[model samples]
Target: METGIRSLRRRWAAPLAALAAWTAAALPVAAIAAQNTITIVVASSPGTGPDILARTVSQQWAAKSGTAAVVDNRPGASGNIGADHVARSRPDGSTLLMAATTFATNAAVNRTLPYDPVKDFAPIALLGTGTLALAVPPSFPAETLKQFVARAKAAPGTINYGSPGNGTPQHLAMELFKQEAHIDLFHVPFKSAGGAVNDLAGGHVSAMIVPLHTIQPLVQGGKLRVLAVMSAERAPSMPQVPTFREEGYDQVQVDVWYGLLAPAGTPDAVVRKLNAEANEALKNKDVVASLAKVGIEPAGGTPARMADTLALELKRWPPVVRAANITAD
Candidate 1:
């Protein structure tokens, strides 16, 4: 046992020494450069969830550190434009990407991404996560998922579900559900989720999958009935609404998450600093309250954890896309 232990230690000694030397050599300069004005670039339109979270968090970070923090909105190309920009930015940590689900989804479906999704960015911390709710018009006979599936299967294409677009996550999730349940509901595409929800409420569309924040008020007002949530677990705001997993349709898990990342090869110290600050900011009462009011749960965690999440999402979405043959026009 002593010989075996000594042999293992000898095997690890050189790499460990090299790592320690590299870390020691990098820290002094990083410590001095860490406080320079930092800009977080968000790949979202102004007033969108990622933009709001970026602005709020940057303000809190600035106040806490006596430094300047800025949020630059770069919204376009389904969030790839901003993401690609950050992927190519310098690894000095002055520029960070305030990214959303589009980061993973784009990598999942795009055949010609300009940068390596896994190698070109350093995942910093997850900001928050939101789920979509399954809403149907009050006029629909089915109140639960089982009944809804039965009704749709019985009528074939007569029953339809509305989505913002063909290749969007909401559309793909419903398609996965349809395949699993052997139902044949028609898909009705709209310009946006809001438009689909509007028609669902007016009975023009039978049902729609929409984010919880946008539909919670309508659900509370008794305008549209929530059948189930498209999350692995139920959302906190609607704890009474069972998840599709709990309802025996386990394939409907979908969520929109916001997180921060830096160009890959960023100093490990910088990534750690950003992770610590972002997690601390999420605990602030004002920040928590603001996010909760919109149904986004704070999800701050280490860069390693965020990287694991991004990896899983990238693997999860592509099979769905191919199975459904979903392509955007």
Candidate 2:
């Protein structure tokens, strides 16, 4: 009996030893991947809306996934600096890019780009959409959107409007509005939104279109009059305001959205893992509340939907850019 037992133990030992060794080798890899530090690259400077959104979602993702995630600010060349970095990074799940409406806007205006937004990255998830508001000073000559249009036409090229920058979405929105309204307004581009906000509140600028949140405080303080939102409908945060479409200009619906993207060729499983975790993070109550504070509506969707969004934007913005004569500056 003892000899038979020893024979059986010897036969099992080799397979068991091999199994133990395999687990030992795989354990560290699994742990590393699960705990690996991840970075969400924001292609803009700190304190920008996309940077805030990236940091918010990534912090929640880290806490829930047991992995460290951070938003890295890489601002330059209209978000190309950070975007190109992620595009060149290895196809691991460790790095991601904050893909936003500006990415498509940049592509629309600039003919030559360092990387293809669609081909160089995999759309993982959409975090949310940030809406813009169009407003004038409380005492501006125009009381309503139609009146504003009439004023612009009456004094062509004399109305000066401030925006965040030259090629910014705010500037573009006003441009499209001008085109559709058949009016001309002088463009006064600011290096930052705060400057424009101050000028608008002080009545130095005739009109301005900026992020919905940027104008919320001023509008609430009764410093500015919101004419119309550049969306299909009014923002929940400010329902009293009407949409440009509602104001007889339906051609100025511009949506500013932000999404997560992985490097092209990232494994399908890893991409799905990221999408799932991001969606889970978006569902958190605190995350939802934070997005609301910034006037962003949370949008969680499949990778394919995000990809389709980018594809649609690519097709949608070029003609507008050409029509408005927008260019990189």
Using TM-score as the measure, the top candidate is 2
lDDT of 1 by residue, 1-329 (tens): 99999999999999999999997768644753656588899887788778988888988888887657788889777677888899988786788999887777776667788888888999999899889878898999998888998898778889988997766667876877887788887889997667888999989989887888888888888889998988778777888999988888767788888899999878887888888989999999998998887778899978988998898888988887787777764
| Predicted candidate 2 versus true structure: per-residue lDDT over 73-185, tens digit per residue | 99998889999999999677788999888888888888899998888999999889877777899889777888898888898999999987867777877887888889999
Q: Candidate 1 clashing pairs?
A: none
Model 2 worst lDDT run, 10 consecutive residues:
24-33
Q: Candidate 1: deviation at residue 251, Å?
A: 3.1
lDDT of 2 at 224: 92
Q: Pick the candidate with the highest lDDT.
A: 2
RMSD (Cα, Å) of candidate 1?
9.1
Worst 10 residues of 1 by lDDT: 27-36
Q: List candidate 2 segments past 4 Å from native.
A: 1-35
TM-score, candidate number 2: 0.88
